[model samples]
Target: MNKKLTLSLDDQVIRKAKAYAKINNVSISQLVETYLGEVINDDEPKLTGVVAELAGIIPDQEYDKMEYLQNKFS
Candidate 1:
């Protein structure tokens, strides 16, 4: 089941959001709903547990060998 709701947004924000919606092949309303749902029902406790698992595992230390040259060239 779903319900309708209305809200106000700045014109520029709406315009950009619409473009984002189009690029992603979804309606503006859907994008808004997804964003709102994520924010309102955020699982902070679960996220903390995931972060805890990565305690000392520094991701991609191999990138340091390139001296971050990939960013400059690519």
Candidate 2:
């Protein structure tokens, strides 16, 4: 289920958010929605366990997985 929302934000914040959303390939609405959902649900602290600690041990990455598999199988 989805609902439309209207928010009041500062000009600079809106501009920066738009720039970040564009770079991250998501809509500003999506970025805000994801953030709000995370905050409301309070999921961050669950990552304190050992397995969760390993999550950041690897640096973030973007990969073309399909291309890699195709080349490997070619």
Candidate 3:
């Protein structure tokens, strides 16, 4: 179920948020929803189903994740 939300924010903040949301390929509503969900959920990113399955594929080995990603992409 989705409900309508009305927020009052600074003009500059709204402008920046709109630009940020557009660049990230999501609606401002999604951005707000994600932010609010994280805050309400104590900032833990909980994954489930297919995402959890794929996330667990990598072995729990001592490795630099950023370096691995850089090497993989580069």
- lDDT of candidate 1 over 1-74, digit per residue (tens): 88898889999999999899989999988998898888889877344576788866776555574766777788
Top-scoring candidate (lDDT): 3
TM-score of each: 0.58, 0.56, 0.57
lDDT of 1 at 10: 98
Q: 16-53 in candidate 2: lDDT tens per residue?
A: 99999989999988998898888899955556578786
In candidate 2, residue 3 scores what lDDT? 83
Ranking by lDDT: 3, 2, 1
Clash number by candidate, in order: 0, 0, 0
Residue pairs in clash, model 3? none
List where candidate 3 sits over 4 angstroms from the true fold: 43-74
Positional deviation of residue 5's Cα in model 3 after best superposition, in angstroms? 0.7
Could you give candidate 3's per-residue lDDT for residues 1-74 as a string of tens digits?
Answer: 99999999999999999999989999999999998888798857778799988996777888898999999999
